[model samples]
Target: MDVVVIGQIARDLAVRVDEVPGPGAAVAVRERIEVLGGKGANQAVALAQLGCRPALVGVVGDDRHADEVLARAVADGIDTRAVVRCPGTRTGLIIDVVDGGGRWRYLQDLPEAVLLTAADVAAAAPAFTTADAVVVQLQQPLPAVCAAADRGRRAGATVVLDGAPPDPGARSDLLARCDVLRADDSEAGLWADAEIGSALDALRVARELRARGPRMVVLGAGSEGNVVVWPDGEAVIPLGDADVVDTTGGGDAFTAGIVAALHEGPEAAARYGSAAAVLTVSHTGGRPNLSREEVAHRARP
Candidate 1:
């Protein structure tokens, strides 16, 4: 399948340490991994690994880091033909620090130039037109997100939205253009306007969201898992059992999984998403190491 992922593209540096050092203190970094990252790139990478031909549409700085990341994306079987490189802008960077407790802190250096603009989306029209599914990261500017969704809809593609709209004013219009919506914990709470402490609370909120526009709404309900609501039914799929090492890119992978397996139905989407989350959290960094073989093998009994 041809999938288009609209989001960020940047460098990622992940460090694993026993504990975060105190102010001015020193601690040995147990492991260090640097790879291609950003929510959009992560999802595109996961989609590519799941047997989809993914085209990534995002911005990067015209710097050495940009070259490295684009090269890596190409090596990973992602089409970077739509990736923009802005001159005089430094490439985005994210430093993920994980402690033994499984908590993570990120030092991010993403500037405005790394963000997508409406013109960029317009320029990538050909990519959107060829896509069977289009996944948009709502963290981008309102114009860009809206443009991407509208283009996908015009092309008769399955438009999936991740995160919340950039602005409340455009939320309704944007949501109306998408077929599926995936919201993380913070975004879900924002949609609920309150803490979603239980799966039922998430289901109620998801049901409300499903009415807004999207045919399916999935909300993260903290430790309980993900709640999915569709036109005919709803389901609360709990997190899978796994040794979680870090949760930096769990949601990204879950979104990819859902979009990848959506043809099977909502139940399959939820199961695949939960399985992808488990696999992602079992790793050390936000860069997902996913494959259709491993995911299906691990998800099944």
Candidate 2:
């Protein structure tokens, strides 16, 4: 299946720290590295790695970093033709701090990414029109995302939203435009009036979120598994056993997996997402070394 991913494309600087420093406390960095990351880029890469043709539509600066990011995406078999190069702006950057226990915190500067406008989405109409599904990461401008969703719907393609809408008031409208909505615990809490700690709580939130507009709602509850609520019914898909490494892009990977497997029912797609996430958290960086064969192998009992 062909998928179009629209969101931020960032150059990530990752550092290993003993711990997150307390207020004004100094902490030594154990290691430092750079990688291609961003919710949109990660999901696009994951989709390509899973044997799907993915076209990325986003903005980056006219700089060496932009060249590197696009180069990597192309090397990974992603179609970067829709990615725009904005002159006089620096590429988006993200600083990821990973602690000893594998927890991570992010500091991002997404100036150019957030500047993506409706015109940019319109320019990529061909990609959206031909896609089987359009995956939008809510990191970009809300208007741009909404525009892409409208185009996808008009083209009779599935509209998948990977994150929560920035404006709470627009939540219902955004959800209504999406065929599938995937949100983390925090985002789900914002949309639903519930604290998602247990599977039952997640199910409650998923049901509530589904009512907002999406035909299917998937709520990720870390190790507790994912709660999927569809018009027909609901189910809880458990995560697989894997050595935890870094969870920087686990959610994005899960979103990609689900989007790629959407031809199946929501329950089966959730299982595919669970398998993809299991492989993601076992590696470092937001874009891990993943393959469709490995994910399918891991999914098997």
Q: Which candidate is the best by lDDT?
A: 1
- Per-residue lDDT of 2-107 in model 2, one digit per residue for the tens? 9999888899888888889999799998878788888888998899888889999989999899999899889988999989899888999999889989999889
| Model 1 pairs whose backbones collide | none
Instruction: Report the lDDT tens digits of candidate 1 across residue range 1-301.
Output: 9999999998999999999999999899999999999999999999988889999999999889999999999999999999999999999999999999999999999999999999999999889878899999988998899899899999999999999767877767877899999998789887667888888888888988889899999999888988889999888888889899999999999999999889878877877877888999998899888888778766553
- CA-lDDT, candidates in order: 0.91, 0.86
State, as a TM-score between 0 and 1, how close model 2 is to the true structure: 0.93
Backbone clashes under 3 angstroms, per model: 0, 0
Q: What's the TM-score of each model vs. the native?
A: 0.98, 0.93
Error of 2 at 118 (Å): 0.9
